[model samples]
Target: MSARLRPLIAALALAAVASLTLGAAPAATAAPAPKPAGDDFPHPDLRLTYDATVRYRSEQAAIADGYQRTDECVEDPQLGGMGYHYVKPAHIGSTDPTRPAAILYEEDHKTGKRELVAVEWVVPNTGQSWPVLFGQPFDGPFDFEPVGPHYSLHAWIFKKNPSGVFSPYNPRVHCGPCPEGHAHP
Candidate 1:
């Protein structure tokens, strides 16, 4: 080919390569919105209910029950168990006696027996509602530990919030070493 034609050919080749590279580049993905800060935490209408059974009795029954319920519901099925399930309330309501409430269904994994565990109701504030539920493992007249290696299961119910999305708390949020044997605070 002549020098004049060769220059045009090279220019076209360069343009083609440039167009291909640009087209192959991935489009930028939008970043997720940041979470609200402090009391500004996004409070959306929510209700959660579940059943709970205690395997080991603790002084803080509510805390223990909540932990167990959350764990079981969120358990991974591939890891030899059913994972956590998020349930939406059948109706939108409040924490007041007149409003619908959330419920959790808990069971003793070992005995296969089930019972109601916790109840949460949403109370409105400035047009938005926040979740306030009775802590886990209803404390009754009796407090006892598990006899063997048994686990508790529960079904938690909640009201779907348009703005509220559940994301696992960041483990790096804590500074010092976790409490004794505990993995993350």
Candidate 2:
């Protein structure tokens, strides 16, 4: 074959191989589909808040993350318990869903075990608009003691709240029986 013809043939062969290689390449793998929000978590906000706060399911984890347990365990004789509050001073008056001002824990009277059940956002009322989260408004502009007039919202993500996920009190949660001298606050 003529040298020029040989060179032209080699170029055509290289081009064909390149084309075949490119055509045979596997398609890139697609990312897995995200889970759909279920009845347990009807909104993306709730899911995101859960994802951010679930790590604090243990009291120690919450403490390590800058939460300090309040001396009192809050409960209502008729409304049920709100559990022990572990507050993070820096997060006070925060509206950020991921940065809750308090972590709530329910104590097992029998086993003496503490389990984190909820997260709360609190902002003092200065006649400002009430803080809202997950499409629901904050629960107060009323006096809550020490803090005086404030608005608060709770998210019971770690544990199911029968009173409603955002309710201030959970019938299932308890500070357990108050100690001999320690009364339920």
Please report the candidate that would top TM-score against the real structure.
2
Error of 2 at 49 (Å): 1.5
Clashing pairs in 2: none
lDDT (10s digit) by residue, model 2, range 42-116: 446777777777767667788898999776888887888888889898998988878889988888766887877
Tens digit per residue, CA lDDT, model 1, 1-185: 89789989999999999999988875567574222222122322222111122221221353333333333442222222222222233322333322322333334444543333323332223333233333322112222232122112122222222222232212212223336667622
| Top candidate, metric lDDT | 2
Candidate 2 lDDT: 0.79
Candidate 1 positional error at 125, Å: 9.2
Against the true structure, candidate 1 reaches a TM-score of: 0.23
